[model samples]
Target chain A: MTEEIIIAGFGGQGVLSMGKILAYSGIMQDQEVAWMPSYGPEMRGGTANVTVILSDMRISSPILQEFDTAIILNQQSMDKFEKMLKPGGVLIYDPNGITRPPQRTDISIYQVEAVEEATRLKNAKTFNMIVLGAFLKVKPIVKLENVTKGLEKSLPQRHHHLIPMNKDALTRGMELVKQIR
Target chain B: MADYKLMKGNEAIAEAAIRCGCDAYFGYPITPQSEVLETLMARKPWDETGMIVLQAESEVAAINMVYGGAGCGKKVMTSSSSPGISLKQEGISYIAGAELPCLIVNVVRGGPGLGTIQPAQSDYFQSVKGGGHGDYRLIVLAPASVQEMYDFVNLGFELAFKYRNPALILSDGVIGQMMEKVQLGSYKPRLTNEEIVARYGSWATTGKTHDRPRNIITSLDLDPYRQEQFNLKLQKKYREIEEKEVRFEKIACDDAEYLLVAYGSASRICQKAVDLAREKGIKVGLLRPITLFPYPTKAIREMLGQVKGILAVEMSAGQMVEDVRLAVDGKVKVEHFGRMGGVIATPNEVVAALEEKIIKG
Candidate 1:
């Protein structure tokens, strides 16, 4: 099976890293993966996005227009990427600053209170991990053990101490995510 | 030992250069390819391998630095994007004329004069057809994936020294910025001055030695007949490369009615398009040229006999298609489909073009 996903949000939202970590997990599971970021000057502080294609077979063309899943973070991402989600696909978003939620009957819609959960944990840095946790609950494309290994591999050795906190955020996110339609 | 690591394409190029026993790297920062220099700067290879890493003020200065280093019989390289590469052409011509061995990497972006910073193959003509003023050709290696980006650095240097010419790794913004798993090789020690002198003593400008006559490295030949002879020598060397160094990948060409010819990032898209076309019961295949200069002309010619038509896909208006046309020699119908100014043609769109241009045509 293949999961063609787009994770989009503001630059500092860890959108690219989230895709990287997910891609790393795919590698840990011995799956083929491609992670392509939208780079250039506009990617500095403005809207940022990354396309992660995880597949059992070889991946072709990391540049994608439509996606199997659209994991949106901000209102801008939700509005922009909602149209690109395939019919009967998954649309997961953080309902924090979303003024207009996704209104599509064709695809499954789910909301994860990642921002609120990160605030409760008093760790805004774990916001992306929380959202990632929610994504795993919905899709489970990669096993959690692989994700654990991926996190350990991706983070610096000095930052290993923070793994437990990130894990805690991940668990909280899985619990807080609710299916909409 | 091969160690697997996940890295971006540009970073892979830098790491591979260090491991390939590179003597020096001179480059100016450009979008999509800046990481090549950034990684070299961060590693400070001078401390380890004695590789000199200098951020030259402009692409011109950087290429000249490569010329100087190559003239000394050292493995030197410079990298830039499309526009920056345009600035290095004069220096490139000098390096070629001097018959200096060096590596020049162009992580191409969309172009026709300061075009978008997006990936494009519009520089195909400039890279393979001699961007600089001369009757010279660069050994152009087109890498499609991040792993190739790692492998081709060492390969480019090896080919450069083998021919004593400036070789080019013609990549684009997509491969430069994309991240993937790459198995990096062990580090090789840079050749010592004695070893270089022993191998290149006949032509290298390694300063006067008491045992041998002073070596002179100059492209300037005032005598017209001698200059023509020099040009002919370069032509013979290029002909030899074309005969022995053609590299390409053939995907599902057996019993196919149409062929899609692409290189680099465009080839990746064409691969997916081939899969889509096969699913639609259209016998379409992909022919990806790894060496744009050598061009795999013979393979393309043979495939042209089997296929009814060819679709030359690119990220340019229509650059590589000219080469395909030249290879096919009008034996079969050939058409071009591409998106310029940084816009990439998706796999489905490539399939659509294949159906419209080749399959249905």
Candidate 2:
């Protein structure tokens, strides 16, 4: 099975890093993964995004016009990418930041207050991890354990201590998703 | 050896350079190519592999650093986009004149001036026709994917050292910024400095000694015959390169008629057109040149004897089409379809041009 996702938001929203973490997790799980960032001058502050494809087979093209899922952290991103989702696709958005829901009726939508949830964990930047945790709960493309292993392998030795905190955040997000569902 | 890992094109180039045992890397930051510097910096090649990585003040300084490292018989490289590469022509010409072995990468963007930082193949003529002054040619390798980006970095160094000439990795912003599954290859280290000095030190400018005559690396020759001899040597080397280094991909060109000739980013778009034409039974194929300098003239000329017409597709305003026409020598019709000034030609536009030029004809 192949899954393509686009993580989009403002420049400082950690959108690119979130995609990179997903790609690293896929690689650790023995799946083919590609992470392509929006390059050139367009990535300064105006809608920075990354396209990630995780597949059991080989990936042909890294440029994807349609996505299986879209994780939007802001309303602008939600508005820009809402129409490009595939039929029966999944969309994960931040309810606190985006007030308006997507107009499409063919896809499943999950609205999580990621910023609020992460702030409850005392780290607002862990909002990306909350989204990742929610993504793992719904999709099950990669095992949650594999993602933790990936985090350990991908990060430097000095930052290894953050793994437990990220794991805890991920578990809390999974629980939050279950509660919301 | 064939294991694959997902990597960006710029990161793949850096990894490939390290695998090729690149001795030194000096470059400035530019869009579409900053990842090349970032990857090198993150990897800390200096501490790991004893490779030197330096961030120069500008493109001019970086290329001159290449000149310095290459003068000392060390494997060196520097990368930039179009405008930055334009600033490096002086140093490139100097490197060419000195007959130094160095690799230069041009992650091309739209240009004539400080154009937008988007993918464009408009640097075709500037790269292949000698962007700098004087009679010179660099071995140019055009990579279409991340895998080729990894492979060509090693091949570039090999070609540069084998011929004592400079080499270029000509890539566009699409290939640079895009990510693909790249199989990381085993690191093949080059010869040590001591070994290179012992082998080619007779001519390399290390130092003047009492037992040996002084070595000069200047290109200035006052006598006309000396300059002519230099030109002849360059021509001979180029001929050898053309005979051995011309690389092109022929897709479904063995049977039936119409052909599409493209390279770089345009080649990927033309592949879609070819596939669509096949579905309609138009029998269209693609001929993509991987080496722009060698031009793949023989392959194009061979196809001219079989195909009805060939459409030259590019991001520039028909720069490479001139070479195609010259190669075909008016044997078969060679038409051009291109978009200039940072515009990309869509598959529909290319197919429409093909229909008007060949299918309907």
Candidate 3:
């Protein structure tokens, strides 16, 4: 099975990083993956998005018309990508940022108070980790263990200490998903 | 001969260049090609292998630096995208005129102006027909995947040094940005500066000793006949390159009736199209040009004996198709299908075009 996802938000919101983590996790899981960013002039102030495709076989194209899942970090991301969800696709949004729910009836929507939860955890930047946790809960493409390994491999040498804190945030986010469900 | 590791195309190129014992790298950063610079920076070639890595102020400066390094008989290289490559044409022409050995890489992006930073094969004519003025040729290698990106880097440098001419790795954004499994080749250490000095010291611009005369490296000749003779020598070198270095891939062309010709990223897409066409019981084949220059005219000319029609597929409006038509020379019905300005043609679209334009037509 192939899972195509688009993670989008403003630049520096870690949207691209989130997609990269997912793609790297897929790689660690011994799956074929592709991570493509929306490059060129559109990346200035407009919504920046990255497409990540994880498959059991070789990925032919990086571009996707309909994604199986979308992680929207901000309201603009939700407004931009909500319509492109395939039927029964999952929409994970940061509830603290998005006030309106998706209008689609066929897809499942999970709104997490990502920023608020991260703020409570005393690490506002970990909101991306929270969204990633929600993504794992919905799709479960790779094990949380694989994601931890991916993080260890992807993080820089100096920032390796943050792995535990990020893992804590991920576990908390997963627990929150369970509580909401 | 070894196991493969997953790498981006740009990283693969950088690694391959290092392993090939490239003496120096001078480049400016540009999108779709920036990872090349980043990879070289992280490797710290000077600390590890004593290779020179310089980030130039502009593409022009970078290529001129390549000219200087190459003139010293070192295995030097530079890289950039379409716009940056356009700026480097002047220096490239000088390198060609001076008969220097250097590798130039153009990781292509869409454009006429500062166009979108998306994969494009639009630089077909610019690369193959000599981007700069005068009668000169660049041995252009088009890479389709990350693996080819690595393989071609070594091959491009080898061809440049062997032919005493500039060679180019003509890749596009798709190959540059994509990640795939690539086998790193065995390291072949390049010649040292002193070794090069001892070998080509007669013509190289090294300081003169008491017994030796000063060397002058210039393309200028005051006498018209001397300049004509130099041009003839360059032409002979190009002819030798064309005869020896034409590389291409033919997929199921043995008995195929319709031939689809493409290169770079577009060729990979056409591979899928050929597969789909065969599944539909259509006899279609793919001709992928790995080396854009030398034009692979020999292969295209040979294919003319069997193929009924040819479809030239590309990301540009119709640049490479012109070359294909020239090679075919009315032997087979030749047509063109393309998408420009950062748009990629899908496999389905290519199949549809082949069905309507060549197969059923």
Please give the DockQ score of every candidate, comma-separated. Answer: 0.65, 0.34, 0.23
- Looking at model 2 chain B, report the run of 10 residues with the lowest lDDT sum: B1-10
Off by more than 4 A, model 1: B1-3, B199-201
lDDT, ranked from best to worst: 1, 3, 2
The residue pairs that clash in candidate 3, if any, are none
TM-score ranking, best first: 1, 2, 3
Error of 1 at B82 (Å): 0.8
Real interface contacts reproduced by model 3, as a fraction = 0.15
TM-score of each: 0.98, 0.87, 0.86
Count of residue pairs whose backbone atoms collide, per candidate: 0, 0, 0
Q: Which model, 1 or 2, shows the larger DockQ?
A: 1
Q: What lDDT tens digits, residue by residue, belong to model 1 across residues B1-361?
A: 2335778999999999999999999999989799999999999999999999999988889998898899989999999999999999999999999998999999999878998898999999999999989899999999999999999999999899989999999999999999888888999999987888776655787777787877777889999999999999999999999999999999889988999999999999888888888998989889999999888989999886689999999999998899899989989999999998999999899989888877677
**lDDT over C-alpha atoms for residue B335 of model 3:** 89
The sequence of per-residue lDDT tens digits that candidate 3 reaches over residues B21-105 is 9989999999989999999999998886778899999888999899898887888999999999999999998998898889999
Q: TM-score for the first chain of model 1?
A: 0.97
> Model-by-model lDDT, in order?
0.91, 0.84, 0.84
In the order shown, what is each candidate's alpha-carbon RMSD?
1.4, 3.4, 3.6
Model 2 clash tally?
0
Q: Residue by residue across B1-361, what tens digits does model 2's lDDT show?
A: 2456667789999998888889999999998889999999999988877899999999999999999889888889999999999999999999998899999999998888998787788898888999999989999998878888989999999899888899999998878987766788787666675678786666666667677898787767889998999989999999999999999998778785998999876887787677667887888888999999888998998887689999999888788999999999998888889887666677768889999976676
